[model samples]
Target: MRQRRWFPPLALAVGLFAINVVARLIIRLGFDGNDAASGRASIIMFAVIGLTMAVWTFLACQRKRPSDWLLPDLVVGAIAALLLTVLVGPFISGGEPFKDGAGDFFAQIWLYAGFAIVGTLLGYWLAVLLGRDYRSRALKAFAERSKSKPRKVVRR
Candidate 1:
């Protein structure tokens, strides 16, 4: 097995973090005055995060071993994004991390996880339909090209 490179995962984490920042800023700016609006914005933010993960998953599947990147990358990226959203976001928005109560905190977690799952499924399925997924396209191309060649036998 090859040693895993840090740059790709780090870059992924950074990208996820940036996504969160954008979502947070958007909510803060657009819906700061209303709690209901802000709550909706929060849900939207989670959805965006899921969409990001889905896209990432699709692209990662373009590699030789999609699982190599998909699982670890998704886990790391999700955790990183969750931490930023749960811990740092509240502070940036001028509130205590857990001041809203345990139920609210758990609700946020559930929402984020749910969105990530939905987004990932959407991305994976889309990639498969487009024939752009890593293994699928590779196998398809291999099958097509193999049919064009005549097999030769050699004496051992």
Candidate 2:
């Protein structure tokens, strides 16, 4: 059996998680005071995170056709990154991750999931719209099948 490589997705997840940590640390150190500044920092963080996921998804889709492993691996990486951002990031920033409340906790989860899912969908859909996805491949196959003529066997 061929062994599956786990390094690419794992590295991407860890890198994304590190981005979260850096954002948290910056917010904690430089924008910790004014409520408006903190809010802006948080929004910026979320935007950056979302955009990063979108770009990553877009590139992944362009690199290969859709497969079971592609989306699932991306989702897993996003979840892992999200967990690191929420569970461990705040500690590094000298703050509590769930300091706001449980509601905020779940909201972060929802937000991360929403961004990841939307980005993934957008990437794949864009590929499909451009005739570069599995649907396109199947359509091409169907066209070829319809165009080809079957050969008749000659009997003695």
Candidate 3:
């Protein structure tokens, strides 16, 4: 086993945090005048984050070692997003952190988790369908090359 590098996952987590900030900003700017609209906007923002994660997962699967990025990358990214949502978002909104109903807070967590799972599945399946998934493509290429060569037996 090799020691995993931290920089990529750290960068990914930072990127996730930036996404949360941008989403919050967008919701704040575009829907602040109406509470209902703001809530909808927030939900859309969360969906976008999930979509981003899905795309990232697909790209990561194109590599020889998809596992390298799957678990840690997502774990760190989700944590970063969660922290930003819980700790920073309310402050930016000029409200106490966690002031909103518990349902809203829990909803955020559920929405984020759902998005991450859906994104990961979407990415993985897309890679498989495109014949670019790490293991699938590797196996295909190996079979092709083996079929092209003649096998020889030696007695020693």
lDDT of each: 0.78, 0.75, 0.76
Which regions of candidate 3 deviate over 4 angstroms? 1-4
Q: Is candidate 1 or candidate 3 better by TM-score?
A: 3
lDDT tens digits by residue: candidate 1, 30-145: 77888888877777777778888888878877774666776677677777777777878777676767998999888888887788888888888988889888878889999999
All-Cα superposition RMSD per candidate: 3.1, 3.5, 3.1
**Deviation (Å) of 27 in candidate 3:** 2.7
Model with the higher TM-score, candidate 2 or 3: 3
Candidate 3 global lDDT:
0.76
* TM-score of every prediction relative to native: 0.85, 0.78, 0.86
Candidate 1: what lDDT?
0.78
Where does the lowest 10-residue lDDT sum fall in candidate 1?
A: 1-10
Q: Which 10 residues in a row give candidate 3 its minimum summed lDDT?
A: 1-10
* CA lDDT, candidate 2, residue 139: 81
TM-score of 2: 0.78
**Model 2 Cα displacement at 123 (Å)?**
1.4
**lDDT tens per residue, model 2, 5-46:** 566577668977877778778888897777798777767777
The TM-score of candidate 3 is 0.86
